[model samples]
Target: MEDLAQMTLDLTDRRLLSELQRKGRIFNSDLAEKVNLSASACHRRVQRLEAEGYINEYVALLDARKMGVPATIFVEITLSTQADEVLEAFEKAVQRIPDVLECHLTAGAADYILKVVAEDTEDFARIHRQYLTRLPGVAKMQSSFALRTVFKTTALPV
Candidate 1:
């Protein structure tokens, strides 16, 4: 919601996003062929998407367990105060955690939601004790361990 949408893309942009989802590192020429556009045009559109912040930096999606991050935890954080300064400090602190994959400020019983990855239960406990509960203005931290990840995605419907 931060960036205003401009330069409305037609079906070509949708196709380009779809191709990127299928192969993030796909060559520009190959992507152009798939989307029925010239290589230069495809590159330009992709650049535009990047500049607009639609496409953040690309990363190699890794297997969590193989990478020694076997545990997935979602923590709901409740802050001690609702003041702007309090919330900003809490957000800034939590965003620095490497294990935290995603975070969202929410409208519900909890103030914030966090998705974290760790090697096991002990690792999560350490993160919770040392980071989550100790974060500035944090009043409560509740964690739910994932039994299984049935669905996960980086692609958005174009």
Candidate 2:
């Protein structure tokens, strides 16, 4: 991954990124107006940013409750061994499970932490039975269910 801190962005580039972070679907003309640039110039900058990996792909955020997968579960997994092959196998297996939203290799008590979504407790139970237990090198698994979401945002500070 490119280190964002190493990239030197000018005022116009920063403005362009900030505008896009606020509204990813904004048109080139509208973005240009907001950032005080010509439409063509804004478009060129955006294309360059994408090519250079400063801007990743845009995606639509969905409502978990409306989508019938409101229950958010955080799971901590400990592996039997910290070997490279064990970690790689666990990661590859976790990626195939659809309910898993985010997974991270951690340093504290757990080898990995995962954020998962399910319809409810019953759905979570089913997922645990069908998927989590089947993950390779899983020596221990601990889970916590979120009662409510305080806030969530996809926008990154530019």
Candidate 3:
């Protein structure tokens, strides 16, 4: 295996990645034809791409509304201190919260930001009382409910 930093994506590889991003379950024969490569070559390239960490795990994108958890809440959390133990404890505890979709260590006013989902505003309040308030070292916390999602995507440009 070669160093990932040194590996460059050519046109064919880029095409393969782009195609895979849009249609992950695309058949190898169909993918090869789209990318203008032989089936064996395409298979090898896909394997190499995965091995090199160009491709991460594939997953099904679910509908939040259908799942009954459509409400989106963005939480800005300010810790009491920037101590390593406080940060570590908060990060570890936040990961255990199933309602929290994403937790990011951030810059600006807040030490951390959390993207959370719930059935509704009441549900969020329940989550806040049940989970958020109990998080270690939380000095100040602010939450904003999303009225609507103007744009959202999992795909990144290849």
TM-score of 1: 0.91
Prediction 2 global C-alpha lDDT: 0.93
* TM-score for all models, in order of appearance: 0.91, 0.94, 0.95
lDDT, candidate 3, 60-123, per-residue tens: 9899999999999999999999999999999999999999999999999999999999999999
Better of 1 and 2 by TM-score: 2
lDDT of each: 0.89, 0.93, 0.96
Question: Residue 147 deviation, candidate 3, in Å?
Answer: 0.8
In model 3, the runs with Cα more than 4 Å from the true position are 1-6
**Model 2 clash number:** 0
Which candidate achieves the best TM-score against the true structure?
3
lDDT of 2 by residue, 1-158 (tens): 35766467899998898888888999899999998989999999999888778898887888888999999999999999999999999999999999999999999999999999999999999999999999999999999999888988777786
